[model samples]
Target: MYESFYGFTSKPFQLNPDPSFYYGSRGHRRAMAYLEYGLHQSEGFIVITGDVGAGKTTLVRSLLQRLDSSKVVAAHLVSTQIDADDILRLVAAAFGLPAKNVEKADLLLQLETFLVKLTAAGKRALLIVDEAQNLTPRAVEELRMLSNFQLEDHALLQSFLVGQPEFRQTMQSEHMQQLRQRVIASYHLGPLDLAETRAYVEHRLGCVGWKGDPRIEASAFDVIHAASGGIPRRINTLCDRVLLAGFLSEKHGLTASDVDNVVTEMREESGPERSVTPINAMPGLDSSALARLMADPAAARRLAEVAAGYQASRLEARVEQLEKVICALLGLGANTTDGADQDKERRHAG
Candidate 1:
């Protein structure tokens, strides 16, 4: 709905991880270097850990985009809750190999043969597994065995394991010691800083061809940065929703108040207390917790403002309704250029 108004070619803040929209902030740059170094070395497992909404997947996608396909064979996999055998099968399937009903020995042999072929062709094979925190101890051990497949000088196959911070905790387990030993490179992708957070939002908007008077106000970014803690996914969600709020009000430029509404709305929907929860009541909070919460006066005001308007009986329902409306509007905005006609089918049906 706001795409043309904003002069964007597409929705700038869509949650989907698109490499084209990736903003290589300092932390992201370091993470990308870690991934690139791992690939360049043709080493064993390279592990990347970050919080849920951090840009690990985006970093991976960026690396894939720049990789020389002619000399690099890459496979990506998600949904990694399987057993050891299933893990190998999934890996094989990623490489377009028939994995069904294949025994472990046969699967290894097939993979080895494939690796040898790639090596002979002067190409490196890379396997990327996302959400690997779910992998069991045995599954990790099984993955470690793949590192054994190497020529005299270099590894024949490399694996990149990307997962949430819990995966790092998992790796620290005694059972994973051997696998950790085999890891040639690893990085913890951290959140963007305040400046980078602002730049990130602008970069994503620009990627989608935004050329209008910037819909997002400068003051709004401080609230966004505070609310989202510089997490890319959360930023996208909040920014996208704020745009909807602005559009609904027919505002050309977003204000801090617009961003406040979105952040407050998010908090109400995400938890019982729309404002600050007591320090002891919250888990995983440290000594700086209270200080951090109070540090951003604007964010505090936004949270308080939202909490003030939220009635216990109607909060959840209202939040859900707003979320649906916002999403529908965003979907309409996204469809304007590429698939506008296809979206018309729904209107025709209605």
Candidate 2:
């Protein structure tokens, strides 16, 4: 809603998965490297785990988009809660084989033939199951069985299991010893740091053709970092709401005060402790202390620049404290000016 007002060609904070907005934080880049390596080596099973909204899906989407078409056949399965037999049918359907009403034996034969054909044609097949945590024991077992399809010396079909953190727990279960052993490579996507959070915001904005320096107060950015814990989806949600609030008030830039209001509103709507900004107010920390940095354009710019270069966790902590103090001082200045204005108004009325 605030796109035009902010001079953006498209929405900067969309929830949809877009590779253009993918920020390669250390964890993300490492995961992608693992994915790329797995694809090249024809690894048996690649497992990727992360917390909810940690961009697992986005990473997978980006990986698939870069797959070598001439040498690899990639099939993505987003539904994983089906029974073992249905899992077979889903895999069959993904490769354009006869799946509906087909017997298990018939489906397996068809799949094996397809894999053999792909191998003969100088290509390999990839089966990517997203949300694998939702898969039942039977389904996971079936997936393990499917991994058995191999040539004399090489695996024909490579499988990737990607899901939220629970998927890791599921894999680590004693019952899944076989499956766990089969995972040739695995990675857990971690949260982006504060510097990454800033770049993440800017990268998404740039992707949507935002050329103007859309002002988000420094204090507001810190609130976003703390609230979102540097998760992309949470950042997007807060930003979208913040932009809407700006639009409703006919403003072009977002102030620290605006972010404070949005954070409070989010806390009230959602449960008090949820990390993801609630669709409604959830309990959120006050970020008004960052306002002073935002009031001065140069200082805000310098803070952003310094944050970009800051790589140590300890140093970041110190800088964050300094930023808060500056904001508090600025707040005091504003309060004093406001008090002076009120005194003048009282004298005139008297």
Alpha carbon lDDT of each predicted model? 0.73, 0.74
- Candidate 2's residue-wise lDDT over 108-162, tens digit each? 9999999989998999999999988898878998989988988888888899999
Q: Which candidate has the highest TM-score of all?
A: 2
lDDT of 1 by residue, 123-210 (tens): 9999998898988878878888987997667688888999999889889998888888889888898766666778898888878877
Model 1 RMSD to the real structure? 14.0
Q: Flag clash pairs in model 2.
A: 265-281, 266-281, 266-282, 267-281, 267-282, 268-281, 268-282, 269-280, 269-281, 270-281
lDDT of 2 at 294: 40
How well does candidate 2 score on lDDT at residue 39?
A: 88
Off by over 4 Å in 1: 273-350
- Candidate 1 local distance difference test against the native: 0.73
- The number of the candidate with the highest lDDT is 2
Instruction: Evaluate model 1: give its TM-score.
Output: 0.77
